[model samples]
Target: MALTLYIDTARWRAHQQSVVQQFPGIVPVCKGNGYGFGHERLADEAARFGSDILAVGTTYEAARIKDFFSGDLLVLTPFRLGEEPVPLPDRAIRSVSSVEGVRGLVGARVVIEVMSTMKRHGISEEDLPKLHAAIEDVRLEGFAIHLPLDRTDGSDAVQEVAGWMDRLNAARLPLHTMFVSHLKADELARLRQQYPQTRFRARIGTRLWLGDHDATQYRGAVLDVTRVTKGDRFGYRQQKAPGDGHLVVVAGGTSHGVGLEAPKTMNGMMPRAKGAARAGLATMNRNLSPFVWAGKQRWFAEPPHMQVSILFVPGDAPAPQVGDELVAHLRHTTTQFDRMLDH
Candidate 1:
């Protein structure tokens, strides 16, 4: 069985070089299954990028990456006070989002996160003073802010960040570095020029790894293939064939995040209408599957299983044979690839 992420190493490294050139001192965020490349591998890749610090989503994620990466590990999400505390490595930098977090982590090196417009994590601007008070004995490493993706490109976000800076200054807290996400290159440059004393560490994940679509590919092995005719039953659910075609089973499914999807960013009314139309078609058993063969996307005979997906090929269209490979266009962040191709 094979569920792989094929790499164009030359092109991938080229893109990484371009990113480092564009955003100096960029912290490559190797979290969330390492954008489908796995965190351990991404940590190794980040080390090759010459980064001193790597950020993971949680402490458990840090253990594996830390073993491979001998750099400072920053866990973005702080361990709450009530939960069972996972002892962090000495090099681990925690994000103290609230006064509770700061109080809980006394003497621990931490970055105080002021809540951004994103509102996913972090404390509010008013709570900064409370956080400042709680971290009296804490080694405050820096500050962190997470900006919403939609507002990442504009000048307003810069002004918003400036407001946070003003609040931090007013609180009389001394900070050196700042961890920021979803800021444009130009915006970061502008901020750097404005605040020369503070080192801005751009926490980048998607734009760092999957930024160049042409540099990477996802593939799965063709485990088996069966010729099916109209009314012939197949698959675990014993789904009957709608027409004469082939039932192709590939080595990727729900376990590997094959049938899973992230929320789509809907822009306008037209896009919403298109999505609705697609949803209607999917209700009729014509759901579009990502597995591609002979330049055409096949349909799933039923819902994806734990470790494999069954695709239906049309009678007129060409089908993949057993032991063949097929490319899958999927969401990397949610996917878990069982294999990765070498250069």
Candidate 2:
């Protein structure tokens, strides 16, 4: 009846525990659909993981999960002036990346983010002195550095983090704890070895929850199945069927993040060519669906509707009956499931 996310609870929990054990002082990041588990659910899981600090993407998210987590909330987004006011608990630690941000959040527990190679947010190195001066009124928790995912430029994350530590030491700033992102376990270990005094807590999300792909499965329940001839017109746009087959209506559509995809970075020439081909096909309204039938991904009869998708199951293949569940390959971060069942 719905698009459901089924979890192998035992395997999933085992993976989580393994990650927690691997990364000492790991701050479980519960943000942005909670990596497909929802924020409140992740909050409870973080509690079960015995994490003292939970990192959320925004202050409003911190406020939402406060009752469920009962631990310190670290807001990753830098707090800016004149932002929508949200009543957050005292345990919410604001991340301030600029002098103005520090001044704006006076008396609030704060983490100063230094500009990383990513260049997304954070105070520049030259502004470290100014930020140091502005943080007198606020409770400075520590510093944070968000590293870029691609290290293809030969830039080592461990070395980069060490360079920041050196800069902080030279600037006479506190180096008690440094929260970092996008660092591998070995990189984190090297940092700990280099700076034995500083506690480096990796803010992990995807690796912690979605590390084991085999532990989770997505299924779209078959709502209806109608047989059609080769030239039969069907669907909203009255598109002609490519051949004789069964039109399988599955319970997942645009609302469930079906038929939607994030922009992919097509780096090489072959990828760009493939992108062009996909675009060319899209113009003709001939697109592939994510729904898998009989171990094969089926084609969409037309663009998916709001609550259901029509997959063309060719006559040569076995057609699924109504009430059956079709496996769907979906991006967890983008998907909104009707239910998450744990076995």
Give me the candidate number with maximum TM-score. Answer: 2
Off by over 4 Å in 2: none
lDDT value for model 1: 0.85
> How far is each candidate from the true structure, as Cα RMSD in Å?
1.9, 1.0
List, residue by residue over 1-343, the lDDT tens digit for candidate 1.
7989899999998998899888888988988778888877888888897999998988888876778889999898876888766766899988878888888887898888888877877878768667657878788888889888785355487787878887888888775788888888998998888889888889998998899998888888999988999999887778789999988999999998998877788988999999999899888877878899989888888888899999998789877888888999988888888888877
After best superposition, candidate 2 residue 332: deviation in angstroms?
A: 0.8
Candidate 1 ranges with C-alpha deviation above 4 Å: 152-155
